[model samples]
Target: MDKRDYYEVLGVSKTATVDEIKRAYRKLARQNHPDVNKNDPNAAEKFKELTEAYQVLSDPDKRARYDQFGHQATSGNGGMGGFSGAENPFGDFSGFGDIFDMFFGGRTARGPQRGEDLEYELVIDFEDAAFGVEEEIQVPRTETCDNCGGTGAKPGTETRRCTACNGSGEQQNVVNTPFGRMVNRRPCPVCHGRGVIIEQLCRECAGQGRKRVRRAIHIKVPPGVDNGTRLRMPGAGETSPSGGQPGDLHIVIRVRPHEVFERDGTNVYVDVPLTFVQAALGDEIEVPTLDGKVKLRIPEGTQNGTSFRLRGKGIPKLGSQTQRGDEHVRVHVITPTGLSERGKELLRELGRELGESPSEQTRTFVDRMKSFLGNS
Candidate 1:
């Protein structure tokens, strides 16, 4: 059969750059690879033709000759001598392994891999989160078996080398292709790439090298750790299946909402109820803080929703023992409700003394809003 043009085979123009040629070849090779398209009888032939075109065009010297003399340049001593040989027709194509690995489950010999990490949602009280606390938490994780010493063998009997792969943990498959035998190395099926076969199963762990057990781990939670804060505990997770280093345990902090206080990063906020008389006259009143109740001065004419900062009275800063956050005490004036006749009379008298007319501040605010609203 007559061979197709090299550029036409790869679907690339003669002026296409080396990178463009490589990209086009990879896309076509992946789609037409014999293993990927087993049902298509012509897939292997197409793939072989694509490889032949790529081998010549990819090399600069060969490509120059082919561009000048066409298929005549690839016929003699300078030619590839057809695809049948001990030599790989694909040449130094680096992307061949990637395509091969993708089609066939290209897993190498299994080695000791690190275990999976674990996440535990630790619900701590608001006070506990504000103040650093050492908590002993019970974590369910996989640990190496004590009886068989993580060998998955009986106490007396020992594990033997895998006969299927000859203890190499991998098996090489020789595939007969048009371009000679291709060797594909993958993990052994008998030993599952462990290189050893355990004839006697562990009595305790039931052939598995690890067992599930609940372990108590102490975690020192730092102060000012807000909700969703993750505390990583190294080597405190599940034991590795292949005997590598254990994974880390992530302690995700879930702070219980406080009844009295709300926290933001480092600062703490608390709404304190104040009597109208206390707000009007100004008095030293006790307000709740993270530490304890602290005396806050209610200045005369303190309005509702007035916030006062109590310096260094909030939650302690994380990782800094000396630095602390301020506590904001927002005062909400409690209006006198279900008042007696005498109480009402006293308030009326106080109101009359204060005057019913709008204050200077109130009049200025009203005028600004009227102007903003385009009202007279």
Candidate 2:
């Protein structure tokens, strides 16, 4: 039986562009993928057909040949997995760059390209996070060479063309088969595909046009930047081998844990322990803030877990001077523990005078529970 038309199978028009053909194939492949449709036995076959259709229709020369000779032209065109051997029915590898870039993301080739981005972690005190600070950081990196103007040549001489590729930068890889000819294009390994070689090397950079150096840079950290925040320093990363533009430097912030306070977003929370006497009698207590020690008044009969809000006392909002967050102080009344003999005796005497039992609250709770059970 004759096979289905490739364009109709992929649901694309004859006039569809290469990009449109690829998009349609990807959509159909995803829908009919074996992993997505495990119950359907034909899913694998459908996916294979979609890929084959894409491989043919996406190429200008391949599509022209198939249009004229039908399946005879693509029968042995080496169209990946299906055809036996017709690899290079067409003869150019320029179109394959986009396909490779889509899958590997620039990993296949690297020359005269920018250096990879770098990340640095910086630990700062809480005070610095609350109130912005300017700091000097020593960063070790490679920089472009000043001598020879980063051309990788000696003071007066220039580079020479590569004999392997004749300065074309691309090396044609031809595969001969009984069905037809196939071609694969890649960077020429010799001379690194730049189509040139440095016959005269630079004394300063050793012909690399870059060298390692350590430099100190002043960075201003914004206020309210919490841990895990990133600050970008453009063009501060390692230098490229070919003296290309430098990559970016990312500074990741790490806020040190404070001894007395914890941070949640812009709000600062602190647990303040107070004695029972102090909570009952109400006293002015000293509390620590980012600025300095400040007095906080505790109301009489203040209960445990009671929170007090101090406006404009927390960390300043990033990039704004007029706005600030609040600080919450949670009161935790502390009960006396491990009392002395004299203290225990005085406490017992006072309890008897006040007609208070040592387990007054607990006994009252038990009594309430009994009444509830009886009612039930």
Candidate 3:
């Protein structure tokens, strides 16, 4: 069967940007992944198709050739699964590391890895979510010992290389089975993979070269940060046991509910109460905003639920220049109550002048009811 067009398979246009193609490919690949859809038998084939489409379009040269000659440009290449040593047949021959590497920035060279990353949740007020705030927090973590200076030795002592593993930090084990002879390697037990042993242990940290300490970290919260927003602080996590790089510290944000304003993305919504007289005969009203109170012009016949927009009055956009959303102010007309005798008399006179002529809204409702009754 003829293969589908590369752009069509990835659900992208011919003029689609590289970033657009990447995003589309990631979404489709993640959705049709066989592991995610185990009940579907054809999910593997679907994922393979998405992977092939992504592989061709992601490369500039391949994409240009495919665009010029369609599938004929690469028909000479064997079936997608040409590699003999592939572990996964449906993952574009790269297994599951692609997604993790793309999002997590990938790992470093093969060796003793750094410490594990740490995360902490922080709940800030609505004002803080809109505007930035500075906070000092205490974090309990592992730090290099002050006594041994992370060397695990006493003041005048030194460290010696391990003889068992020859300072290579690994031990190889050989086993003979029916298949063949197999060799396995693991961290050396002596010196614990550090390749060195201290003659005299440090008194403060007890030869661990690290100690538990409570550190004070100052964080600068940026404006317009929403819930689930993660902030990364480099080298703020636990120190590596092998003296490598320290992991990062992640801060998750949780914004509290506001009393008057409700935020959706960048926009903000607020309910502004107005008097009946003001609704009938237009008036200027003051409404609350993030910056301050602003005057909103209430046009004549502004009924309940009428909304006005205040441009550039909402929350600021994250990592943008002077870009902001508009604030929507919904009018809620308040009825009169607890009227004095004089006020009642004046209302009675006004009611007589207006007669029983209902407003346009009421007239439309009556017409709809009449139409329904007639049809019934």
Question: Which candidate comes out best when scored by lDDT?
Answer: 1
lDDT (Cα, tens digit) per residue for candidate 1, span 181-231: 566787799988768999989989988778899999989998888899999
- What would you estimate as the lDDT of candidate 2? 0.79
**In model 2, which range of ten residues has the least summed lDDT?**
84-93
lDDT of each: 0.85, 0.79, 0.79
Best of the two (1, 3) by TM-score:
1
Candidate 2 colliding pairs: 77-86, 87-182, 88-181, 88-182
TM-score of model number 1: 0.72
Winner by TM-score between candidate 3 and candidate 2: 2
Estimate TM-scores for all models.
0.72, 0.71, 0.64
| lDDT tens per residue, model 3, 48-140 | 787777766777887887788777766643633232234233333254356534432442234656986888888999889877789988878
Q: Each candidate: RMSD to true structure?
A: 6.0, 7.6, 9.5
Off by over 4 Å in 2: 1-48, 51-97, 100-112, 153-158, 168-170, 176-183, 242-244, 338-342, 349-355, 359-362, 368-376
